[model samples]
Target: MHDHDREALAMFIDYQRAQNLAATTIANRRSILTTFARTTGTLVDCDPFTLRRYIGRDARITAGTRRTERGALTAFYTFLHDEGLRADNPALKLPVIRVPKGKPRPFTAEQIDTLLASGAYTRTRAMILLGYYQGFRVSSIAAVHGHDIDLVSQRIRTVVKGRKEVWFPLHPMIAELAATMPNDGYWFPARGGRAGHILPSSVTNLITRAKKRAEIAERKLTPHSLRHAFATDLLEEGVDIRVVQELLAHEHLSTTQIYTQVSEQRKDAGIRTLAARDIPTSSGRGAASIAA
Candidate 1:
């Protein structure tokens, strides 16, 4: 990479760190910017065509990954333009890649029962229950500490993005289990005296093992699937979509609306209702029959 580009990349990384972006995000941006510098030699030379070659139809990465790379480059060039380092942002003109949206596959009730009964330890069971009942992201589940649970009030507190702390009513089963845990540290403490709760990856691993033990055939079942089950179950039961949105802590109602798609059981019930309705059969004497 040219000296000017290297210097610009370093300055941009420093700016990102100052903005308090997550380490993983900063690392990804750094890697993408470095590659752009190496490939194109300078920011002044970067244009829409150059970016297209890196992320467009000819790119080897998945569409989703390409989108991420495009986003990173867009941010970088925007920064350069705002700082007066570049005259224009070429990344802005890159065509947007539309990745197909896949419907969420939630765990069946029977599958959830089997998973719970598959010999998960106490802490793991509590984690699974929280995700299944509360619709918590795995990161939020892992961050839960003992103090976050209020056995007396049957509530649990969690922090979401932007450090927004919210309290949710705890399920009775989860509250009862929380009461049995150590009160001074993490509800799901890290193994071997680590200072914080178990990592999100640990929760994921626990679910994977439990799924295998239960012989679940759904290959897509993961910690997040439990969350999907939580949302879909509420929707299937005819709960208001807005209520589900709040329960799932979704920022937008549109996000929750996806769950409104009828489940198989609900679909069957709807079809049955239609079948129960009576209608006169069409016949050659239909008009005469009506007159009679």
Candidate 2:
């Protein structure tokens, strides 16, 4: 029984290949199946008990992790059923776990001012501003060439996430930074000439080091956090969530909806503003007392 189960797992990998699953997906399936095999004892003698035990053990892991395992098991058993072996997917019985809600954390306005003030080089300053204001992913930022920026138009055409091309209009500050930078070099230059597109790690490290130098704590500052700040700032400014979604190049509207949840403090402020207008003056207070 164990050997038969092992054979079933191997056959499933082949089926995944035939379906043209992405390499990453293929790797994950292999990992999950391998975990199942190990947890089940010898595959040749395995039974449904082994499957249940594996899931039960992983129930102690986080909901997100268990969900991943559940998905992999479902796929595995589906393959087995198609191959005329197992008739049911035991992993389907796994309970779903809810992921906690989290807001996009952005840098304070003061921190942004300080970071830009610290970077001496015009090019470095522009790169930081671009990351903060335009929300370019590191790859998109690195892809920026002297030619891609249209100063006359005050816009940059960035290749984002392979399939998407996002053109971000430069804010006045960003435009000024770009204007000061040399138009001949990679916006953030690397060595080895053309092949030396700026590495994301290099900029991430630069920001991390700069934050440390500026005495900013590790509580919230990060390179990607700047992008989140960019989007959130726009939302806070009353920009439509749909427009922000386009600016951020989010594929799903739900991804953009997360930022719409304002902080509790802000909500309280809004309520206070409304309440202030309805407060009675002295004469109105007397009229209300007489009516009561």
Candidate 3:
């Protein structure tokens, strides 16, 4: 990054810190802005044309990546404009990148059972449960401390995406495990004292290894997939969507609603299967059956 970009990014980083964003979120914003500055000439001087052109340059970039880049750039330019660094926000006029509405891919029940039943170390199993049952982000799981677990109240506190501290009812197994963990430090403490806790990536690596041992096909199964399972499992059992939303700590109902589609899709699949075996789907019975 150029000197101008560095200074601007430093200031923006501080601003993000002031808003109490999670460290990962701040780092991502910095990375996105820095990459944009390095690829283009100057951060402060980029107009709408350059901004859009840069993002559109990569044919392999997924719609999700484009959306993330757009969000970061927009946030950066908006900060610059708000602080009087620029007369106008260049990002304001950048064309809206339409992101496809994709369904959440929750892990199947057998996948969950297989992973949980794997003879992994206790730590790995705990991390998996924290995701699959507790619905914590991997980052949140990484930051788990004995302080976050309260055996007295039967609740565990988690630092979520926005650095929001939320306490949820603790699982008995998690509470029992907490009793045996170090009370003075993080459960997943850094081995080398590089930081307070292990990086979230480390937690992910452990889970991946466990998944491999379970002989599950190495697809895009991730910690987030465990969280998806947590939500989907509840919804499948006819739990209220709003209650699941609260458990997932989703900020918007729309975000939680995607899991509903998962349930609907399963029902559709069953209908199609039945129609295939018993009734011809070509007779429109499948469609009518699904609609009704």
lDDT of each: 0.81, 0.71, 0.86
Per-residue lDDT tens digits for candidate 1, residues 1-292, read: 8778778888888998898776557888888778776766656458888888777645567777888888999888898899999989888898888976647779888998988899988777878888998888887888888788887888889976555789988988777777787676777777886777787788889888888989987786788999999999988877888888888888988778777774777878877885455666776597888889
Better of 1 and 2 by lDDT: 1
Query: Taking the tens digit of each residue's C-alpha lDDT, what string does model 2 give over 37-86?
Result: 77565443345666556666834576566667768877876666666676
Estimate the TM-score of every prediction: 0.79, 0.63, 0.85
Q: After superposition, how far is residue 262 of candidate 1 from its true place, in Å?
A: 3.2
Ranked by TM-score from best down, the candidates are 3, 1, 2
Candidate 3 Cα errors over 4 Å, as ranges: 117-119, 264-292
Stretches of model 1 off by over 4 angstroms after superposition: 1-14, 20-47, 57-63, 85-87, 191-194, 275-292
Better of 1 and 2 by TM-score: 1
Task: Give lDDT: candidate 1, residue 256.
Answer: 81
Q: In every candidate, how many clashes are there?
A: 0, 7, 0
